[model samples]
Target chain A: MLITFGAIAIFFAVIIVVLQLSGIKDRDFTDYAVGGRSFGARYQAMSFLNTWYPGAMFTAFGGMAASAGVISFYVLSYSLLTVVLMYLMAKPVWIWGKTFNLRTQPDLLALRFGSRHIRTIAAVVGIISGVPWLVLGMQALGTLFQHMSLGTLSFAEAVMLGVAVIALRQVWTVRMGMRGVVISDMAQGIVAYIIGSAVLIGLIVWMVLARGISFDALDQKMFAIPSVGSAEGPLYLFSLILTGAIGGWCWPYIFVRLFTADGVESLKKSAALAVPLSLIFGVALLIFGMLGSQVPGVSAHPNDVWFIVSKEAGGLWLLGLAGVIVLAASMGHTDGNIQATGAQIANDLVGNYWQLGERQLIVIAKLGMLALTILSSWLACLELPALFSLAVLAYQGIIQLAVPQFLGIFWKRGNKYGAIAGMVVGFVVAVVLELGYPGYLPWAYGLTSGAVALVVNLTIYVAMAYLIPQSQAERRRVEELFDLIEGKRSAAAVSKGVREPA
Target chain B: MSDDGKTNPNNHAAWIIGWFILDAVVALAPPIYWAFDRNRTAILGLPAVVTYFVAVAVFITASIVAAYLAEARSGKAG
Candidate 1:
């Protein structure tokens, strides 16, 4: 069964590789990496879903839900709510991307702040911020492979399998950049959704008729998974949800994606579709969790839920399909995010101080992705409590941008000094709280840091906008950026399901 | 805050509708729970909490109703 599954998976993988590589148009690195910053709704939606929602979260979330009960929905909802936040921020980000021709976050900071110092801080922070996520993704990938192997492979062998595939996949990523990444993502999204939906419907029907189960029965069974042993209050839901949605828009990888869309409306339309797609995919995991609740037949870990479901319910060929789809999902995620962070480091930090060529920039970006992929693969071996924890930790720090960036974009008085201060302060506070207290209970609520970031960012922005005076050039740049965004929007366009950032 | 925090000052009603939807999503927890509990299997004397469970039911009548109202309110007075 395992051999048959692996064969089917390899076959589907080859097809995906051909589809992704067939039309690679990345003549240069920026085009390869950022796709020259022009993504319509379809591409945006495809890439966003594929790239945004991967890692151990997908593999482990179902198990966590099985353990945590109703609270599990919070994790899933937190993931989905980010799209709504993305919808709000996409307008400013796209407008800025178009105006400044910015490809990386550091580029945006440098363009506006005109300070290499600020860009360096932001770039380094981007790399540092992204490390845990990369490692977590690698870990989840390794875990999934091992658990799926069912003792056929050793632990080290499992990790190596994940690493080998990632190493192979980077060959294309190093060449094509975001264009290749998106094409690959679109492929993954299409294939995964089809397979995922088919599996879900099949499971739903099988469980109802064959297994004789319902959602309520499933919920009741799964509810006792996360035992709250006097930790945070149930209100933790409120904080986590608030932080997840609000802080979510600020994530560097996902944030960079907003800038890659074709236009404001395209971005928004993609967002409208993207949110529900994320939710549906999420529901598939939840259902799988419900199936696993109190039932034990396989020796798989949290990350192997998809594989387990496929292997148990269907034939060997379907198991192979599940493996390839999961791997594709992982690759699509790492490609854009790793490369984007690399570009940020090279351009924002190195080039900000000294001019770097497209060739040099591309080389550094490739190296960066290579290093990040390897590092993440290695990190996958460690005992990280759960995928959900790492995901939240990642957002807990970055979400501080809820005030400084997401809200700051529209606010006129939003000055660089205030935003910088708020972000710095909020970033520090969040990390400390998360480290010192850490959130497992309902009370700590994910939003404590989010709220702090919002408050500080707003307070600082308002005060700075009022007290500080921008030089003529800076004010003009701000006005130009805003004006371009305002003049371009049309009411009729929105009615046609064209989502605008505004 | 200019009655609606119109930072960019292009439209009014859309902003309200957006923020309203956002706030409602955050504030309304009990109703969400109620719908899940009732339709999936009504327990005891309590009616469904959400008053509208789009997730349950065969035809998705609840989702349509909710979506229609949201659309109507968000629409401009042409």
Candidate 2:
């Protein structure tokens, strides 16, 4: 118990010290929201990893692999596709963000559609979908604390401890803003992913060689994946992969990472860099979970497989390290979500209504962060069994933003009415279907509610694009935005002697 | 388009679309994954299905790196 608690305490102390030395003071709202758009490839990559894989990667996701078999590989598939999307979208997103001083995903939407109403609607959807994940992050911390206590603390006591620690971390998050969140993500991400991968590899080696555990010895059911003929139906895995790949960037927190990069090249490099890291870490972690399922006590409590296996393999010290890794991951995820949500609330929701200065916006954003932390912590303490289900539903709802986001950036004909209509209608359909059908839709041939809604959403968006024409001024503005991107690329090519001036 | 001075805004669209289609086929296609879905074989001490997915991940990573290099070579990485 002492070893585990001490390790976590030392980890927190080092992170706080690193953050303080990194200079958390922001010169203005841009610096506060995006670190003045000055980060390089590595920081952007780590920040994405930190936000993308929450501490639940160890608990819930690992648990899924332990209990559910090869279906969990969907995460790996979608993660690779997500990075591909990042690389593809980096140019327009970064260029527009820098040009318009856009600070949130909704801010980009507003800029693309030229409507405050679109901004408000997107912001509301982003916040509503975002809050559940924040709660889940807090609950993940609760699990980490419970295991770290080593029977010294009850679950309820651990819940409070977890909530309190995360709440305390928000003090710095509120003060230093996105810059602080990104820097700490660097430190925390190294601990959680780099060192965490080493630990996973070590555990796998020990389990395989020492314990003589191999695929042949385990239950054959563990190897089965959902297929065309299976009860899960053909499209189950496809739907999951599609949603994760597209919906990933729709998250305000993850989308905002694009703006933190210094240039499109930095984001491109970050996308490339993230692919291998995600593959290695994700594969190793899930492999460990699968192998650890055979360990005593793991089958009954699969969510604790990470902690149980670490303790069995390497004793107290390894368990301590495991706890620290999960804590690091959870802290980074929670901090980023809080910062991004706060920025959206301040810059998109509130600032859209009233004329506010940069200083006032920063103040409002900090207050928003505080409110979100308190709300998520309180929800975490409730220990609701339905919270995880709500988080899954949030994924369904969040994906509704994808159509508008993709079309708005890639195609200029998508008017504000179409964007708003598609998002509102798609979000409603997702929520209704998710609540009615739960995980998968039988009538839709195993497609998820989100995927079904997306089809309808895209149809409406495309139809509206043709049905409603933009005003001449709106058309010119949209044309100029596209021209800005092309003009910049052509100038860069000419300067590099790759092409002649037009 | 670049040679013609039109400067196609989505010069990399072919790369993105091509890889995306390939990935979907590799990951979700019934013909490919179904071949290894069974646990009759263990490669590298892992179930064949698991090993196949890991290989798929590696393939995707390598593809992204290839695309990045190609973009850089074309001077469109910015």
Find the candidate with the highest DockQ and give its number: 2
How well does candidate 1 score on lDDT at residue A180? Answer: 72
- For model 1, how does the per-residue alpha-carbon lDDT over A170-229 read when each residue is reduced to its tens digit? 767766677777777787777665566566667656656766655455444333212223
Q: Which portions of model 1 miss their true places by more than 4 Å? A: A1-5, A8-16, A19-25, A112-114, A216-231, A298-303, A381-392, A440-454, A467-473, A488-502, B1-78
Residue B74's C-alpha lDDT in candidate 1?
A: 56
In model 2, which runs have C-alpha deviations exceeding 4 angstroms?
A488-502, B1-10, B13-17, B43-45
On lDDT, the leading prediction is 2
* Number of the predicted model whose TM-score against the real structure is largest: 2
A1-502, model 2: which lDDT tens digit per residue? 8899999999999999998998777899999998889898899999999989999999988998888877788898888888888887888888777766788898888878878788888889889888888987887787899899887888888888999999999999999999999999999999999999999999999999898876666677777766667776667777888898899999999999998999887888888888889998999988888888888899999999999999999999999999999999999999999999999889988998899999999999999999999898898889588887888888898899999999988888988778888888998899899999998887776799999999988988998889999878777767767766775333323222111111
Fnat of each prediction, in sequence: 0.02, 0.40
lDDT assessment of candidate 1: 0.59
